[model samples]
Target: MTNHIVERASARLNESTLLEMFWGMLLSRRLDERAWALHRQGKIHFHISGMGHEAAQVGTAFALNRGVDYIHPYYRDLALSLAVGITPTDFMMSLFGRKDEYSSGGRQMPSHFSSKDKHIISGSSPVATQVPQAAGLAFAIQYRQKCGLVDPNDTSQPRLALACLGEGSTSQGEWHEGMNWAGVHKLPFICLVQNNIYAISVPLESQMAVANVADRATAYGVAGVVVDGNDVLAVYDVMVQAVQRAYSGGGATLVEAKTYRPVPHSSDDDDRSYRSREEVAEWKKKDPIMRFQNSLLEDGILNDSLLHDYESRARAEVDKAQADAEAAPLPDAEEVFGSVYAPLEEQP
Candidate 1:
């Protein structure tokens, strides 16, 4: 019932953890930036950005055991994927639809993360569809432990599944159904909602009548909490609490992270039509990466010189990944229908 991670008064914000989290956020930003450029240049077809969700993504990643925990990440999980061992090269391959893309062998869309070796589950494009699937996975984990399939004394016996979705997905029936099931069964599940105040062109006010999505958690008989998605340490602290609760048979928790979407919905969308320049500028001022960098600088954990080097290194990694992806060939013609369907036969 008691755990040190949650009991600690201060967040476990060691210098090393701070550094790792920073690198994840920085690398994700650089990757997203380059991807947007590629889309503009016609090198890539589609692109979705994770500009303002970096802190929350990376913070959540560090809270879970990457290889042990199962993660059902939505499209904008660049930082979470990178933090949990999904390399930038993997993302670049998927983005380019190259043959070497491990996630879906160039089949799935970019930012649809899935790594079997890393325990990252594949997700669908339909919003909130991953919710029920993740609940099922968590139920399996919880069932295995309860039925003695897993040794009770094992350190990683109680593995959990963490699924993330945009706040707009909360409007879907599947999201509520999955949450209800996890709550009733006391399944080891963590539902993360990144509240960016908009769903494509639709604003939050039009999407949901409730002021906060976390308020709905009370209806499920599950623990609910909200955190500043822009603040990496705050998000990390809250996620650790969620992890501890999951480990202790405390069941599901809904973490509604209030963040912003700095860029347009995707490469295809334009913010100029729906949102004002002033609103975008105000949110940009609260950029998660910039805020974290300033915090590190203030704490003496990062100086201007070190920051320059760190940032350059992260960019360099992204550049190499892009180059590698550029050189990699696209999926072969034979592979076009390779995994699409099993019942169909190919025409010669």
Candidate 2:
């Protein structure tokens, strides 16, 4: 939470890792902008963005076992999905509600990310619902290890469950119950609170009395931590600690990443009424992508040529994904309830 603390936790990141992080951040930004463009053109019905939260999400994602750990990501987690190996094509398919998309097969709303190979659990609209689901999954992992179905001695990949949400969801009963349950059982769980200071339209102060969401972790008996969400390196450093602790059977942790959302909550909401243009502009100057780019330049890891190449690649990737999704077919009305019920032979 403090500058001194951050320096102490900071790890020496190599050039390769730094470049990988930059590429991930770039991919996320390109896809996010394309989504907004589609929405403005009336090509999509609704869109929620993760513009200001890229550093926090991408940094946390790099610390996990990419496809092995179970991740339950909330809405506004487009960056998180992309960072964790969910292809731009998969994201576009879901945004367009295409029939072949793996996440709900175009039945559910967009931003509910899911991938069978990646082990990403599809999220719902109800706030904090994934909190309990993540905890339950952690319990299942614990049971599997205990039953010898999963190797507890496997140090290469210590499985865990991650629950991601906005700071506002911390007030929900499900959030409290889930965190408490995990703490009681010492489940290998991590609760990531991307604190962007608002619950739809309500400010952080109005929604909760505490100064920081991480402050409540004490009551749950889990380790509480806060970090600069805009600083990718800082967030990654802290996540390294949390992941190691979980792998070493250190139980659960609550990470409150302080961030800000510069865009409107969604296409349906007008941000002008609730926030000031000056405030948004001020936050824009602290854009995580630019800040990281500056750092890379200073470290000699990025140059004008490399920057241009990365940008061009990212744009092309997004362009191809958009074309693919737009050309794909939508779900059929005849199969509205296709996967809802089991067939007679499979039904007990």
Candidate 3:
């Protein structure tokens, strides 16, 4: 299907909401940038840069209702997590493997964010694990609404669950299982495929024959859209439509955001071995942060001075959060048993 294009100007949206979304993107960018720098300094063990993904992440966050809606985010979704109110300190704590880290209490490796209160489900290192979990949550929402468990008369909407992952994850068995089940049941779920061109060292073209990730939606009989992930306004408009569809019982929609990773897959992998430096440099020119900022400037919604101030504040906040996280205590060996499960009684 042909994509319905939206203007790249933020002025087209509600002014206050547009500003909020812009600020959210800026904050997310700053957090990710600081984390990457910390990794280089050896203060944090590893990091993933969301440099070319701020638009999609911020747009999706603005479209959804935080705490009300469920979000099953992938490892490369630090910007989305932070944009949805996962604090810089919380992220730093996780990066530093401190006891106060909300996701896994420092047990999980860095970049896997999870929070019950924020409705951001815990991330797994395994690919596509959150896909089925998101579908299940959407099913439960429908069940609750049908059973009159929630306000039936309101008709405002039932909550939705978003399962977001990289395009490479689409090749995983769990991805098919989750999409198939949700599509069969006509559940209110949204699957966001961030096609950053490469899945580790492999490109999307090598993984699938389809022209675009959205084309896979044809098998499921749902609306599909492919958008420029670097365009924040375009992404926001598309996500708003998807959110409306799911909430209105229009069923699941699969969105493929065409973007770039702009960095190695992770701290361990070296893309320079398999990918060309020229390709990386070319993608840097269309960097999501620069693109989104340009859009805001074009719309006359933000000046360079304001943008600089926001950047400065973001940097300061990240530094302070890192300091706090670094100073926090690590978990004791005995404390590990407290979180596993309830104690069992001894047999007679």
Candidate 4:
């Protein structure tokens, strides 16, 4: 059933692109597994698993303008960051809180990824904050267009803001406020709700009344869509349309990706308490990485030998990253206040 759908979609993307997607998903899964192991071994203070969300993250990332489009991603977007050029070493440095860690200079928690070079906005601990911030960025992009800073008429250059959040964050007032503003102003914003069934220990039914999170977009008069988040190709297709609409001045879009959280909410939580083993096992049957790999093999894009080689290479890369990060020094206490503010004279 799944193979047929993936096969049809595989034809749309070139073999190299599809292979890249597979590699990202594979690397993310292996990295996530290592993080979990590191947490258990007391090597890391905390860990957030992005085990089941790779397809949606990587797929959406591939659909965007790599160096141009801005992305405001939540913590569990490891695959998304990788697809956007955040290396395994960068993640490891952040995981170990090394002084040279690119994200926050080792100040913030791991997974709060930010890179100016990659067009990724710094994320915060507070949930749903990025929603309004995304709207503001979209507005800024439009402002730049009006000021002739960017050519809006250039169809080739489509600058958009992608705001990603968990479905649980939709309950926050900021989500609604952001959506309302984007809708009214017709901002080039794409709200991606990674609905991973469970918001920590709480299930989707406990938090929202609606069956689909995308339905909330109707209130703001924006295009809302629900896609199989596990299906990488499906996500890519949807994002392509959403990006096109935003670029052409249509309006904002809310994409609800229906996926599952296979691991615990974080390293601190226990999933066995809230969910049954059977349920988790059932979801594993529909594992995104395995599904994609199967399609690739069936389509002759990949083989067993190549799959084995890819896995080995990914693991070795992660191994080197961990070693390098472990050998690096911690952040200096005296420089704690460095990035807090600019000179008073330079302040606005």
The prediction achieving the highest lDDT against the true structure is: 4
Off by over 4 Å in 2: 1-10, 155-158, 342-348
Ranking by lDDT: 4, 1, 2, 3
Tell me, what's the RMSD of every candidate?
3.7, 2.2, 3.2, 3.1
Q: Report the C-alpha lDDT of model 4 over 211-248, residue by residue, as the tens digit.
A: 99998888898999898999999888888888877888
**Residue-wise lDDT of candidate 2 within 30-77, one digit each (tens)?**
898888999999999878888889999989998888878889999878
Please give, for residues 1-348, the per-residue lDDT of candidate 3 as tens digits.
Answer: 454645533346776677677787788777887877888888878876676788888888888877668899998887899877788999889888898678888898987888888888988899999999999999998888888788633444438899999999999989988888778878889999988989999987899999788998878777789988987777888888888888888888899999998878887778998789999999999987777678778988788898888888888898899899989999887777776764566434
Better of 2 and 3 by lDDT: 2
TM-scores for candidates 1 onward, in order: 0.94, 0.95, 0.93, 0.95
Q: Which stretches of candidate 1 lie over 4 Å from their true place?
A: 1-10, 156-158, 340-348
Alpha-carbon lDDT of model 2: 0.87
Predict model 1's lDDT versus the native. Answer: 0.88
Residue-pair clashes per prediction, in order, are 0, 0, 0, 0
Where does the lowest 10-residue lDDT sum fall in candidate 4?
1-10
C-alpha lDDT score of every prediction, in listed order: 0.88, 0.87, 0.83, 0.90
Instruction: Output the lDDT of residue 80, model 4.
Output: 95
Could you tell me which 10 consecutive residues in candidate 1 have the lowest summed lDDT?
1-10
